[model samples]
Target chain A: MTRTTYRWAALFLALPLAVYIAFVVFPLLSSFYYSLTDWNGFDVNYNFVGLANFEKMFSDRLFSNAIGNTLIWTVAAIIVPTGGGLALALVLHERGIFANIYKSMFYLPIALALAVIGQIWLWIYQPNWGLINATLRNIGLENLAQAWLAKPQFALLAVILAWSWQQTALSMVIFLAGLTAIPQELIEAAHIDGANYFQRVRRVIVPLLAPASVVVIALAVINSLKSFDVLYVMTRGGPFHSSDNLAMFMYNESFQKYNMGYGSAIAVVLFLITLAVIAVYFRQSAQVERLYD
Target chain B: MTKTIAHNDRRAATASLASDRAQSSRVPMIIFYVLLTIIVLMYSAPSIGVLLASLKSTAEIAEVGVWAIPRSFELTNYVEAWNGGNAGIYIRNSFFVTIPATIISISLGVLAGYTLSKLKFRGSNALFIFFVAGLFFPPQIALIPLFRLFNDLGLYDTLWSLILIHIAFGIPICTLILKNFFAAVPTAIREAAIIDGANEWQILTRLMLPLSLPALAVLTTLQFTWIWNDFLWPVILIRSDEMRTVMVGLASLKGQYSVAYGVQSAMAVYASIPTLLVFVFFQRYFIRGLTFGSVKG
Candidate 1:
């Protein structure tokens, strides 16, 4: 690149990079600094407290519960969306006419805001008038109906189900793309060998879909880590904070309780976990790309 | 004659076998449609149920199951939800936050993406990786600090805070998408333009920008949906009721109208309309944007 080209590049890149650094990088690094302090987000004078917040976090029951719930959420996010999406994609991949309609229906939830979906599910889970219990009672299964979002055992699961509904469409679309890329001759050869539908799917289709699965699973994990809005709107991580994930825990601690130092510590932990996940994702995806090549 | 007879028998056997395969496939085909219908219904029930609930009166919503249609369609529920109190204000605020945020982010992204992909300056690859890494940084990690930063800047409790934060966070994905898009544009075009004495600016504006309309459209739609549907930033940044975006407004609206299911549902439906329209109109581009970001990135 010539000097003039270099100058031009600098001019073009300067503003956006500056804004990004100011808002994104600077704040992120400062959060790391803040996590080591006793700053409560208010006073000017506070002593540096090293690892004290981390120690407190380890002993905190809510924090541990948040971690546990996050793990459950991540696992659920992977299995439910990937499994449901793969099934739907397989079924819809061969059915062209109705595939459009089905895809639209499945993807509709993704278009809705998390807050709106949270509200919708809140109403659906309403004990008396919500759809679930109402249907259960209408079918003479009143004994089975319970407050879906109110119970500790059910709250996290309920939130996960709603999240999975939104997520399945994403996985399905990715899988559909993957399924499309699979060679038709291979499936035909399997059929010529008299492999039944189940055998074909299990042996041929699912194995070929491993790359897509890697992408879907990575996205699901990252998404589960950031799960907050729905839990905030639906249960507020309530019924004794059973559904509070790391994000919500961070929010409540930092903003609601003004524990800036502790919140920053939690944020750092979440960020590291996210970074690790993304690292694995990139590594696996690189291998997948190599295989394709 | 015997050889001909053997060939005919073999043909009949293969024909029978083909027919049997077809016959067996019919059953699974039936089961496939049945399963597809069930899944579709399950997926669409929430949206449909909410829409139906939005059309019912509060009394009807309470007295009957959401599955039941109202005795009369209360279209006024939408009007009430919009014009009644702060829903209209919230909707307007969302537009205020979304449109400008989308435009600014896309513009900055295009410039940076072009420079990185086409210009090939020193450290450009490193810079691109830096931006890409931003994608993995969970927003929650930055919340408290950004909250404090915005407060220090006196941008808190205002739409600018939300807009700026959205633009900042939106840069990573937008730049990634556009960088890839610009890279795919034939370098020969750039070479020809350079030979014609066209500078980087003219080439980008005249040649690249025009060619990148499809990519720009995808980025715009995706970013619009993202900023429009955002809840976390606005809830934390904009404390004033009038300044609140629709998502936060809808949350508070739920609190106030907890018993008014029809009205709340109407607001929820209203909040979803813009993105839903984008989805309906640009489903292909939207899905492409989504899959491209994940699958390729």
Candidate 2:
């Protein structure tokens, strides 16, 4: 009976496992192999590069810029959305008149495709005739008006801020759920103990909300690192390639430039960097121990 | 004695009802409303812009903010987008890829999640850990190899190729979610089913599966929204115009690189309608799903 059941379980698992290995595992391993060789994607003949691709990568200014942009986006993305979401969640968790409406509304932006969000932001950031500059002029802050996306200094920051608005909704939902799980009795107890609102939030609520924060922050970092659509649509790494992230760089190098070996090398670097970051996060936070336990 | 018991029940009900009313009128109520309104406006800005833009003509959009009410409301953009822009075909391709991928991921996810959660098996922990690690590896890292592999297999530029790729990457998160849900199911129920001589498959299909409807509903709605809005995979995998999903179609429609704001905005609205409709219909399920996983803490 036990043997039969084990066989049944194996049967259930086999197909997905096989498919995953074929598409996911094998491709990744092969990519790593190709990263060491000098193979143009469309080329008929190629030779082993022996880390020459990687050696060239160290001096590549554009590659470094992409990495910097990715890190900046990751940090800013996590901080802004997580912070904003916490405030929204706290307000809504108090059970106001339009609590449900607020949640549904905040969630609206997330439902639209990234393509749409990118296009909308593009219109908003138009240099002269755009909504933003027009609004600034109308508000008597004429000096504040500038070319938002066209200017190299503000372009990536503008894009990141736009991305944050949509993401905060998800983070808010997570935090709201976290808030609800805290027993009302405990909050009342804290109040009775003379804890002010800010104190209560800091000492009691935030600690209780740690798990949700972990999930939201981890996801935010990963998503920001992987963000491609908005960057691709709005700027295509324009303004002298100031807005490019690792993913965009990978795509541009591989498909646009036809440098398969170099692209694979960059990808391998990204893959390793992501792994290292996650490992460091886990190690520093000791989050995994608490999360699984 | 019966009168005393009935009298106590009446008193208890009234007391509970009064407390519920008291909680509603708490001091936090006013602050909640104002904050919610502000946050909601911020969230809906982009979608609202798209809707208004889609209703205006190209010429009007260039002249005014997308949020402006058109002097003459022109809903013709929607018509043009659907018929002339081939949005109909793009939307069709989206559904074709999405439905099959959703079905495969959910079914496989539920099975794998249940097995990992309830059943004892060798290599289970290692496999689970392996998948969890896979979650953090950016898909871009595998793009070149996957593309080449798909090309070699003659699966490039097809919806099946895209669906298969979606399912592969989707498995980890889906399985993780379902496992979390399945673990919440009571052990006693499984013990009872086992006592009845039900096989593993029978117990899964007839007993556990039926009880998991809420979680499955949540998964379905979430999967539909996610798979529907996906852009990167489709852009990378499918090159044919007819094979392009709605997101990619709208993306490529950007006229002369950056000047198609009017038509692109129109296409954005068109692409959003289906998912927005799904969102409106399944708002409760979607909310419950997003919150449910968090609430278990």
CAPRI-style docking class of model 1 based on DockQ: medium
Q: Ignoring the other chain, what TM-score does chain B have in each prediction?
A: 0.91, 0.82
For candidate 2, give the DockQ. Answer: 0.53
| CA lDDT, candidate 1, residue B118 | 95
Evaluated on CA atoms against the true complex, candidate 1 attains a DockQ of 0.66
lDDT of 2: 0.80
- The local lDDT score (0 to 100) that residue A285 gets in candidate 1 is 80
Among these predictions, the greatest TM-score belongs to 1
lDDT of 1 by residue, B1-297 (tens): 999997787667667767986888898878878887887887788989888988998778768866677788888789888787478899999999999999999999999999999999668999999987887777888887898888899999999998999889889988999999999998999999999999999999999999999999899889999999999999888888889899988899866777888888899988999999999999889988888844433
lDDT of 1 by residue, A1-293 (tens): 89989988998998889889988988888889889987787777777999999999878999999999988998898899999989888878867677777778888888999999899899789898788998899899999999988899999999999888888888998898888878876876687688888999999988887788898898888888987889889998889998899999888888889889999999999988888888888898889788866
CA deviation > 4 Å runs, candidate 2: A284-293, B1-39, B187-197, B256-262, B291-296
Compared with the true structure, all predictions reach lDDT values of: 0.87, 0.80
Question: Per-residue error at B194 for model 2, in Å?
Answer: 4.7
Cα miss at B53, model 1 (Å)?
Answer: 0.6
Interface-residue RMSD per candidate?
2.3, 2.9
| Fraction of the native A-B contacts that model 2 recovers | 0.66
